[model samples]
Target: MKKLTTALSLVAVMAISTQAATLEERVKALEEQNTVLTEEVLASQSAGFTLVDSEKTFNGMGPAASKVYFSDNPLSIGGYGEMFYANPDNGDDFADVYRFITYFGYKFNDWVVLNAEIEFEHGANADKGGEVVVEFLYLDFLLSNEFSLRAGHVLVPMGLINLRHEPTLFNTVQRPEIERQLIPSTWHENGVLAYGRFDDLGIEYTAGIVNALNVNNSKTTTPKTGWIRSGRLGSSKNASFEPAFVGRVDYTGVNGLIMGASAYYGEGSNLKNDDANDVDGLTTAMFDIHARYENGPLAAYGLYTQTTLDGAEKLSSNAAEKASGYYGNISYDLGGLLGVEYKMPVFAQYENYNPVEKTVDGQNEDAFETETVTIGFNFFPTKQTVIKVDYEMNDVNSQETNTLSVGLGFIF
Candidate 1:
C-alpha cells in the first residue's frame, strides 16, 4: 500500500510540471504578439495623418499647404474648401461651390520635397462654367535655415492674399477688389525662386524669375476690367515663356506685426502667336506696400498697390496706363471678449480703387473710380472650420449697389 501511494504522488508531480511548461510557452507567444501590435500602432500614428496646427506656418505658406514641411511620414495630404451664397440688389441671386483645393506632397528625402495644389472651381463642371486647374507645383530644395531653392510652377509672392489665399485667412466672403484687380491674388507662373529668412534680422526675402505675362490675351484684358489682372499666364500648355523678375521682402522684427513690399517687372507683349510688329514694347511694372498687425483680440491688415503700363498705347485705344488701389480691414474677436472656447470675430473693411486710373486715350478717371464698404462676422465651429456672413455696399462710377453674402469654409 505504501509503494502504490508514492507512485501516485510522483504522477501527480509530473502532471503539475507539464502544466507549468505549457503556461510558459503560451505567455511567451502572447508577448511576441503584443510587441507586433505595439509596433503597428506607433507606425499608424506617424503615417502623415496628423492634425494641423493653425498657428504654425512654414516659408510663408498657409498651414494646410505647409503640411509636408512638418510631416513625419514621407507622404502628406491636405486641403481646403469654400462655398457661398449671394444676393445682389442689381444682379441675380446665386449659390455656388466657389473653390475646392487639394495639396499633395511627397518627401523624396530629408532635403528634397515635392508639393502641388489642384483646384476645382464652381463645381468643376464645364457646362456650368466650372474648371479644374493646377494652381502651383514645385520641388523645394531645403539647403539651410536661411536659404532655399524652389522650381516649377510657383505662386508669385506679391501680396497678402497671393501667398495665403485660403478662405479662412481673409475676413470677407469675396477677396478685396484691390487685391483682385490690382495685385491679382491668385497669380502664378512657371519659374525658379530663391527664398530665405534672417531670424536675427527678423527679415524674409524672395526673389525669382517667372514667365512673363502676355498683355495681348484678349480673353483676360478688357476695357472695363483692366489689363493688370489679365497678365497672369499661370500654367497654360501653350503659355508664352519670357523671363520676368520678381522680388519681395518682409520685416517681422516686432511680435504680432508684419510689414513688407513686393515688386514685379516684365515685358507683357511676349505673345506666342502674335506678330512682333504688332506686339511693340509693352513693359509692365507693379508694386505694393502691405502691413498686418494682431494684438490679443484686435487684428488689422491692409495694402496699397499700383501697376503701370509703359507702352499702353500699343495694346489698344482704351488701354490703361496706370492702375492703383488700397484696402483696409480690422476685426475684434468677440469670442475672446466673452471668454468662450470657439472664435467669433466682427470685422469692417473699406476699399478704394480705380482699375482704369489712367487711359491711353486720356479718358476721365472719375468714371472708373470704385469704393466699397463691407461689414462682416466670422464664427468658428472648430479650429478648422468657419461660417461667415457679410454685407457689402459698393459705389462704382457713382452707381450704388448692395449685396449680402453667406459662406462656409473648412481646412484640413
Candidate 2:
C-alpha cells in the first residue's frame, strides 16, 4: 500500500511539471508575436506617404507646399488640382482642367532640404493650349529661427496670393482679378532669398534678389497693352536675367490676423542683348498692402497694389506708365451655425482695377478699366476638398458682361 501511494504522488508531480512547461512555451510564443507586431506598426508609420495637415503652413507657403517641413520620412510628395466650367454671356461655354501641380521634396538632413513644384496647365496637351512647366525648385538652408536662406527658382513674395495660390485658400471660383493683373500671383524667378521671423514681435520678413522682368519680352500682347501683367518672365528659356530687389514684411501679432506690405524695384529693360525695342533705363517699381483675418465662422481678406514704369514712354506710344487695383472679400461659414459636420461658406467680393490706369501718351487711360462683383459659395465635403459656385459681373469700360462658373479643387 505504501509503494502504491508513493507512485501515485510521483505521477501527480510529473503531471504538474508538464503543465508548467506548456504554459511557459505559450507565453514565450506570445511575447515574440507582440514584439514583431510592434515593429511592424512602427515601420508602417514611418514609411509611405504622410497625410497632409491642412491647417499647417511653414514659411508663408501653402499647406501642401509646406509638407516637407513636417515630414517624418526623407521623401515627401504632395499636390493640388482644380477644374472648372464657365458659361459666359457673350462667349462659348467650356470646361477646363485648369491646373494640376505636384510638389516633391527631399530632406538631405535636419538643416538642408530641397523642394520642387511641377505644374500641368489646361490638361497638359500642348496642342490644346496646354503645357507642363516647373514652377519652383529651391534649396533651403535652415540656420536658425531668426534667419534662413533659400536659393534657386523661388516664388516672388510680393503679394498675398503670390505665395499662397492654392485653390482651397481662396473663396472664389477664380483668383481675384486684381491679384492676377496687378500683383501677378504666380510670379517666380531664379534667385536667392533670405527670410527670418521674430516670434516675440510676430513679425516675418523676406528680402531677396531675383531675375527682373523684361518689358521687351512680353508674351501676351505688346508691352503697351498689358505691361504689368505681361512682364512676368517665369522660368522662360529666353528670359533675360537682370537683378531685381524684392522685400516683404508682415505682422501677425493678432491671432488669426495678418497684415503686411511688400515692394519690388528693378530695371525692366533688356539692354544686355540687342533687342528690337529702343528702350533704356526702364525701371519698374511695385508695392502692395495686404491683410487677411479669420475668426471662427467669419473670414475677410483684401489688398491694394500699384505698379509704375519709369521709361514706358520710350517703349511704345500707348505703353502704360502706371497700373493700380484693389479688391475685398468676406465670407461666413454656415456650417457652424447649422451645427453640421461639413463646412459651407457663402462669400461676396468686389474689385476695381485698370491695367492701364495711366498711359505714357495720356490717351485711352480708361480703355482697360474694369469693375467686377462676384458672389460665391463653397461646400467642403472634406478638409482637403472643396466644390465651388459663383456668378461674376464684369463691367469693362461701361459694358456689362456676366458669367456663371462652377468648380472643384483638392489637395493632398
Candidate 3:
C-alpha cells in the first residue's frame, strides 16, 4: 500500500484519456462504466490483493493518473484498454486493436485542478484515421503534503512506464524495451510539473520542464543516431519551444520497496536550424536507475538506461553518440502462493539493448545490438481482467525474432 491520501471518493479509474472525447464519446464513456463505476476493478478481485488502482492515491498517482488528485466529485472519470494477439515463427501473423484510452478530470476547489488524456491507436478510423493522440493535458496546484503545481501537457516523470502506464501496473504485455527504447515510453511534453513529498524522508519527487527533442530526423536512421525513439515530438505542429529537463527521485522507505533515479537534459534541435547553434551542438543527456519490489506473493523489478548525444557528428557519418539499456524481472503469485482460489502470475524477463551505442561520426550499427527474452503468464478472472500469455525471444542484428503471444488487459 503506497499510501498518500486525499479524500472525495478517492477517484481513480486508470488513465490517459479525454483529449476532448469523440471516439464515439470515448467508447460511450467506457460503455457507461459497465453500469456506472460499480464495475470498479482495480483494487478488489481477491488473490494476493495488491493495490492496483481505483482505491485512491494522489502522490502515489493512479486512476486516470491521479484523478485530479482525488476529487470529491467536482467531476472525475476514467478509462483503460489493451488488446493483442500474435503468432509467428516466420509466419507473419497479427491482431491488434492495440489501444484505447480515456480519462478526464476536474476539481476546482481545494486548490485548482483539471486533467486529460485521450488516445486511440490502430483502431480509431474516422477522426482523420487511426492513431489519435493527446495523451495528457494538465493544470494542478495544491500546496501541501509537500507542495504541488503542474502545468499543461506533462508526463515526463521518467520510467516505471512513464508515469505509471496503467494495465494493472505492469507484468508485461509489452513495455520495458529499456523503457521502450532508451527511456521513451509514452513520453509527453509541453512543460511544467513539479511534485513533492518527504514525510520523514520517505522521499518522493518529480520535476519537469518538457518539450525539446527533434534529434535531426535524418529520415529515420543511418545517422539519425537512433534518435532517442525517433524524437517523439508528441503533439507536433512544428513544435520546438526548446526546453527539456526531467527528473525523478523516489525511495518509498522500504516496506515493499521502490528505489528510483531518473534524469534528462535536452536541446535536441527542435528549432530546425535557427543558425545551427553554430552547426549543431544539438544536445541531450539521459540516465535511469530503478528498482521495485512488492512483498507478499513476491514481485521484483529492475532497470537501467543511458543515452548521450551532442551534435551527432554533424548529423551523420554514421552518427551515434551512445545509447544503452537493461532490464530485469521476477514475479510470483500462484494464487497467493497456493492456498488456491485463483489469480496466477509467473514471469521472467531479461533485456539488453543498444540502439547504436557509441559512434560520433560513423560506424556503430552492428545491427543495432539487441537481445530479449520474456516468459510469462497472468490469469485473473476478476479484478478487472487479465489473461496474457507470452513467449518471446529476440536477438536483433544477429537476426531471430520468435514470437507467440496472447493478451487481454484491463483496468477500471
Clashing residue pair totals per candidate (backbone < 3 A): 0, 0, 10
Candidate 2 clashing pairs, residues 3+ apart or interchain: none
Each prediction's whole-model lDDT (CA) = 0.88, 0.88, 0.75
In candidate 2, residue 341 scores what lDDT?
A: 86
Shift in Å, residue 378, candidate 2: 0.3
For model 1, name the residue pairs that clash.
none
Candidate 3 residue-wise lDDT, 248-301, digit = tens: 898988888888888889876676446644345678888888988888788988
Per-residue accuracy of model 1 over 1-412 as CA lDDT, tens digit each: 9999999999999999999899999999999999867655755885736456678788788888998898767788899999999999999999999999999999999999999999999999989999999999999999998899999999999989988888888889998988888888788899999999999999999999998876665622345665667777898997778899999999999999999999999987877765754476778898999999999889999999988888777767767778888999999999978889888999999999998788778776677799999999999998889999999999999999999999999888
lDDT at 170 for candidate 1?
A: 89
lDDT of 1 at 97: 99
lDDT of 2: 0.88
Better of 1 and 3 by TM-score: 1
For model 2, residues 16-120, the per-residue Cα lDDT tens digits are: 999899999999999999986765576488575666779999889999999989877789999999999999999899999999999999999999999999999
Model 2, residue 225: displacement in angstroms?
5.2
Clash count, predicted structure 3? 10
Assess candidate 2 and give its TM-score to the true structure.
Answer: 0.87
